[model samples]
Target: MTWDLLLSGGDADIAISGGRIAAIGPGLPRDAREIADVSGCLVTPGLIDLHTHVGPGYWGIDPDPIAWCSGVTTWVDAGSAGAYTVAGLRRVAETAAVRVHALLNISAVGLAGRTGESRDLANCDVALAIDAVQANRDLFHGIKVRIDAETVGANGVEPLRRGLEAAQACGVPVMVHIGTAPPSLDEVLDLLRPGDLMTHCASGIAAPLGPSVRAAAERGVLLDLGHGSGGFAFDVLERQLDAGLLPTTVSTDLHARSLHGPVFDLPTTMAKLLAVGVPLDGVVEAVTTHPARALGLSCGLAVGAPADIAVFDVRKEPFTVVDAHRQTRVSPIRLVNRATYVAGRLLPPRLPAPPAPWIPLTGAQRSALDHRTRAIRDLLTTPLVGVDGLAEQFPRRSK
Candidate 1:
């Protein structure tokens, strides 16, 4: 059977048919209906962000605009919706071009507001959470609970206990967000199961570097670098690296607040790992195979796998990148996405919407946004070509 699309002349020739990779080799047939020449680009599996917020809520942001340019195909909404608001998130997942899965919030209220979701213990209903996960098995991969002073308040680890109960009942893992004390970082880490994830493992505020943290790592609690606006810090990551602890997954907690600065996209977040001395291959694995394995999702660029691919122009130039704390470091290489595909269909370019009113932006950031808007407007308004560049479809009577 003929192939549907051919991605030729990249790192390797890939033939896609029936929404899966038909073949991969140095040379392939050029008879596909659509052919994209991707010479001088790095071809790899589409990235999977393990933590993000894309549902319709306070922190939600459209993932398509970022996905097309950043090569992220699967966006795991980390508790933007819970039992009460999951239907709305379902509608979003169904309509979006990119794949959107979620971790059901322990709090029934969800992130309708910034924080304090688990302040009221009634919101953390284990039965309701178990029901939600069991009912929507396709959409929810696990449960998410924010354990910190701001989110849990006086409840501390009680919400986490209820979340764990629900996760155990549903036979799914839990991804716990780590932040400032009250419950204390050790209290949260001790409760996580072997397969459970500790997001923001290298937070400046939490600084999960004590004996309990090491013990948790030894016992098999996976560490995830959920680099949100305040979750990541270069010093903290470096310290962890010195201790020989590498992040199991790298993700951008891309929401309204973090999108503009610290966590621009997955590529940028990956670069942060690079700056901290992680090898390129390691960083790629963290974003692709590792995260996919964590959530039991399909990923990779092998024959018979779903054709979710990304082509990037790999530049071996120095690039200055910053973490959530505004500390900067230079990366040896930069990965700029040139094209992204999902299920053998190329994603179309999409412009980002204006930042939300409540999202604070610096003067320089505002100016940059304005400049980008004008540039896009100018480009779309301009003519495709001059008169000479056009040809008439209908000839005159002589023709």
Candidate 2:
């Protein structure tokens, strides 16, 4: 059968039909309606970000503009919605071009504000969270709870316990955000189950390097590099690497606050792993197969799998990357995306909306954003070509 699309001249040619991979080999039949030449590019399964904020709330940011350029096809909104507001997030998932999944917040209020969703114990209703997960199994893959001092003031691990209860009831994992001490990091680590995820594992603030952290890792708890504004630190990651504990998944906790810097996108976050001595293949797996496995989502670039793919121009050169602490390191290679496809369809280009009023921007960043906006306006307003460039479909006959 003639394929719907064919990606040729890459590491391996891939033919797509009916939103699934028809075939993948050295040379595919050129019988497709459309073909994209991806010469010298690395073709792989679409990257899945295990942690992010892309629902309607205080932290949400449109994902399309970033996805098209970054080769991330799946975005997991990490606790941006809860039982009361999941419907709104569902609308976002339905309308977005990329795949949008969510981890339901343990707090019924969700992230309607910057923090303190679980401050009031009443909001951490296990019954409500369980119902939300049960009702929206199509959208929610797990539960999320921020167990930091500010987020769970005086409540400590109570919110987490309630979250765990809901997660167990739904048979889904819980992804907990760790931050400053009130309950302390050990108390939070003790509660996570085998498949449960600890985002911001390499946090500078939470510095999870104690015996409790190691014991948790041994017991099958997964560590996630949720590189948000203050989540990742090169020193912490290096120490973890020295101790033989590496992140199971590499994800950008990309939101309004961290999007502009620190955690630009998943690709950049992956580069941070590479900077700290992680193998390139391992890094790729962290963003693709590993995260997919964590959430029980589909992944991989094989026949019969969904035709969710990404092509990147792998540049083998010295590239400097930074972590949350503004710590810089040089990477040996960089993956520049050339194309992104989801369900056998190419993702169209999308411009990002301006940052929210509350988001703080540096002077240089503001200036660059203004420059880009002006450039786009200039390009759109300008005529495509002079009159001579136009061809008349209907010539003035018998004039």
Candidate 3:
């Protein structure tokens, strides 16, 4: 499937050796020592997350353990540090358990806090950014700029301009985060080239799905679904998808705070897109093939492409999913990952964590929580007898 042609579906098996896919067919000799049965699960290339802050930032998290648990082989930390601080970021990435890459922040301080990185235009040193990219070309693949209300309060599109300058100077791509606009989405789209990426596409929308987005998309300006804390609004995504415009790649703009709410994990984000009416195949491709292409990484199920693979169970169940705007939707399918292999090395998925403890609650809050818990416990003790019991415990929303 990596090549221009499609794969023929039949009973098939894949073999790996020396950290590369060796053969794929039936009746292949057991070249390796181990074999396991993986029936009734969909397999694809290892997922490449294009946007994250898993480095040493305020919202950063250690990526490798999470990556292994989530079937993510390649994790891109988006703009956690800037030109002056990227050396430290590189040092951290070098010791990571997964394949780690980063985008050089246009601002010199780079997302140290929520505000003031681009408030002063002097903070964006194009020369220093280019120098950093050149110095760490192996680790830094692109440039990152946040064009939101906080990052660019009065500076307008100057931060983006410097980001573009740095990208052009270093001959790499630019990943722009869209937030509240003073320069406007139209102006931002005008500057981006074909290979450049516009993240947070499902964020706040000021207008309908009109010609501006279409024009940029036609010019090959890729859109990215970076579902951060409040970056993805269901209405915005539905409106855009209704216009037949979908993101080229999907990413979980995962940080520390967002992990607890609206954006739980990458699998939840993928399930959200599937519930929003995107095809399941397209959803998997967005995380695998599309992101690999966007980030210039090699990934596939073919021989010698890479031995990385991910296996998941496509569960069919009724679940209530929520978006960043707190709107709930029903998903008929959930993608639960089971395992990931990095360069022919196997990594198994772990069990999901238990529910959060009520330790951080106030005295009144704890009392209320205990009361609710006991009420639910009482209902459970007498449940499943009849419609009356079910209705009393799980009442439908009042129409």
Candidate 4:
């Protein structure tokens, strides 16, 4: 049978038809309707951002399709929605061009802080989370708990314990946000089962899992690099990586604040990992198969699965990748998104636009927020060029 699309490179030829891969081999059918000659590109399963806050940023009505544009065919909204807000997320998920899923926040208010964070320990209502999970069983894959010291406050492990309880009851995995206080990383890891996910695996200044993190990985608990600017630490990551404690999945803990710098999208994250010695296949697995497995979604590019593909330029170019903590590495090799296809439909290229309302600071304003208001004045002066000059945009202060 003729395929709808064929992407060949690296001894892999993925033939797609009816939204699933019909064949993966060297020879191609000559009568295919469309052909993408991705010879110079790295042909891999469409990327998946297993964690993100793309929803609630654009209007709480639609998920930002940046992932789709960046060769991410599917994404799992990490914990942008809790019981109170999941309904809206469901709406957004439906409208998204990419296949979207969720690890519903255990907090009833969901990600309510910037939009809002449900600080009330009372808001960690397991019943509500379970109810939401059941209601959106197709979209809501599991549960999410932000076990940060600031987010959890004095509630300690009580919220985490409840989140685990809900996850257990639902027979689904839990994706926990680590790097917080109250319950140490060990305590949080101890609470997780084999299939559960740990976002921000290398986060804050100090993260959980080094030797212990390796043990957890060996035991089947998945570590994810949900690098959200401040959520990643190079030294800590290096220690973990050197200890053979690598992440099973790679994700951008992307959101309004961390989208521009430090987190340039999934491809940049993959490039940074490659620069750090992660093999291309390993990196691809982390972003593709491993993430899909974590999210319990199909990504095999096999027959019946979605016909999603991400082509990247694995070229040797002078590239500087940064993490949340201003750690920069200048490397000559980088991976860049060439194109993305969803169900055999190709996505177009997009140029970066002015900072959206959700992100009030331009790249320069972020660097100058602590200095003078000169950057803001510059933005006013140059409305045409806009604030893209601020390569280090910071979070806007609370009004």
Candidate 5:
């Protein structure tokens, strides 16, 4: 458990009931159904993954298993759904017990069919985006626009302009994914006001440690390293840091494509940052308080804060840290989750609850949202992108 009082020092006890943090202190009445002692563990608020893609119309990975297994309580599905597609995707994401929220995609089609959502420009319908955000104001937290060569094609700055237009209307932050630019890094930074975000800041764009980034920071433009399948670099981040740039929040841009290699999970991302010279406290704050504030999610160990806590065992051993581009570094200490508690229900469950919306390792939601599975079945009945076609992704070199 990463307690705020941890730094102050002392053994404190916590009590939970009625899906809330009932109390916290050094001692309390021992009158409870069960009691567990945590003599040696680092306790903190439940980790919030501020960026993820975990629903259909994309290569969806059911979020609960990975999320809970990683000690994540709140998972934000970043731009995986949009105006036209959010309704069904929202259902799939919410069906899991993991608290799920989303940054509504600016494009109407979302990430369906490996399609470049904003490529058509017509997909950036501000009215439709506004409607979606308004309709799902409960779960929709912000707007997302991936302004890159693949997503936006040569449509320079227009998609972001439209996204900003809709975000301004909806009164939520606009998270801009910066990659192979149609709108130059400078152009994107220029358009972003304070509170707006630019993710993948270390993706080795022309985002040099220079005046533009400095100006953005000065104006309170929040930066995040959304370390995705291809969104981080060692030298790039180092240069930015040397030039006084820093991430306000850190998140795993977790998706099916990134689940295996390069970006494994949040702790792995945290370890990589630790290897890069960011202080331990900063690393902790990045995932905990930083994202909580950025996304306006209730987080902490206080009585009113969501009863979400993570117990970590700090390991003082050597570990391999991998960056988004497969770069490696060695870190001194590894933060390992000893246990996690969300709303007082212990994770790695002490006693399994009845058919809850929690971890469903084999749960296949057979609703209409299961259309992606049905489509996969249809493809299997016909043919896949064949072994050879698939093998192209992992080409073998001649012996």
Candidate 6:
């Protein structure tokens, strides 16, 4: 099998021909047309970011090109669309560089506010949600039900109940936002089916998957690490991980704030788990195969699957990782994304350069300038203040 170009071993490779991966293997045949060696790099299936906000309006400005540069090839815009603005999101997602998907917001108005709109049943019309999902079935993967403190307000379980009903009609999973739920996590987990998803799992005082959370997983519900700016907490993650529980899918929950701070990118979030002693294979599975399985996506390196892969270099580099609280930690090792690919296209590269400090001035030159300034300013406070006399005495020494 000849190929137009071949990335021979490292992280992953996509054998592209008709805009899809024809094959993926450890090595391409020697007869391949063009071969690029990727020795000393790590390659795996292309990253699938299941949660993001790549909309058309204020939210659309996010999930930009850097996301690709950072190693994400496919992304899901989480609740960036509502009834009012889904058309705009659909318009842009059609032409975006990265492969984009969406979990439609339950609100007919879409994501117009930071606080969300699940608090009012009047704002959440099941008829409208079903109409939007039916109209844009191709672009929409599921429904987004936000249950935050402000969004749920006094509505309690009513909003989620409506959301679940709509989800049933749509015949797709519902992505529930986990924060302040009135009926408790147990009730929320019970409402969701095996295919339904829970985002923002590591959040607030509420635990993502506890006894019932695990029961939800046992029943086939997908647990997403949807770590956003203010949504992720180390304590919550620790509790779950310590309980020997892992998420079915790991996502960045990328938005405006997380992209710049402690959350970093998908690779960084994976690195956090790695720093905490997660085996390399387990971490890789959580992001790649596991996520794909949870999404009911076939992403193994099997023949005929799309040739999408994410290549990285797991090195012991000094990384200053920040958390949600603005705390910085000097980590000894981290997963650094080197490149990414979707189908058969080689994504833009992400090679980092060595760090070097700036040498502003020579020592001798600095000393001479310091002495001259001191001699001149020394006279400003003197009883006899003579600028000309000072200049004459100084003589402007030069090295």
Q: Highest TM-score: which candidate?
A: 1
Ranking by TM-score: 1, 2, 4, 3, 5, 6
Q: Candidate 2 on 1-399: residue-level lDDT in tens?
A: 899999999878999999999999988889999999998888889999999999998899999999998999999999999898988899999999999999999999999999999999999999988989998999999999998889998998999999999999999999999999989998999998999999999999999999999999999999999999999999999999999999999999999999989788888888888888899899999999999999999999999999999989989998899988889998888989888999998999899999999999999889989999999999999999999999998989895
**Candidate 3, TM-score vs. the true structure?**
0.83
lDDT of 3 at 180: 73
1-399, model 1: which lDDT tens digit per residue? 689999999878999999999999988879798999999888889999999999988899999999998899999999999899989899999999999989999999999999999999999999999999999999999999999999988898999999999999998899999998999888898898988999999999899989888888899889999999999999999999999899999999899999999899999898888887899999999999999999899999999999999889999999899988789999999999998898988999998999989899999999999999999999999998999999998988875
Please provide, for model 6 over 1-399, each residue's C-alpha lDDT reduced to its tens digit, 9 standing for 90 to 100: 676556776545545554455656665555556566778877777777888877853344444455556677778888878877887888768776667778888877666656757766777898988888899877887888887667778777677787788889988888888876565878778888878888877665466756888788788888788877766666677778888767777788876545545565888878766655667788778777776665555465656667676677768787666555554445566777776667666665332211112213346545865675677668556768556656565576699
> Of 2 and 5, which scores higher on lDDT?
2
Report how far off residue 6 is in candidate 4 (Å). 3.8
Backbone clashes, candidate 6: 10
Between the candidate structures 4 and 5, which one is better when assessed by lDDT?
5
Over 38-130, each residue of candidate 4 has an lDDT whose tens digit, in order, gives: 777777778888987755634122334475457888878888888888777877778767788888888888775552254577788888888
Error of 1 at 192 (Å): 0.8
Q: What's the best-to-worst order under lDDT?
A: 2, 1, 3, 5, 4, 6
Using lDDT as the yardstick, the better of models 2 and 6 is 2
Worst 10 residues of 2 by lDDT: 262-271
How do the predictions measure up, each by TM-score? 0.98, 0.97, 0.83, 0.85, 0.83, 0.80
TM-score, structure 2 vs. true? 0.97
Model 6 alpha-carbon drift over 4 Å, by segment? 11-15, 23-27, 57-60, 181-183, 318-320, 326-332, 348-399
Per-residue lDDT for 129 in model 5?
A: 95
Give the clashing pairs for model 2.
none
C-alpha local distance difference test of each model: 0.93, 0.93, 0.79, 0.76, 0.76, 0.70
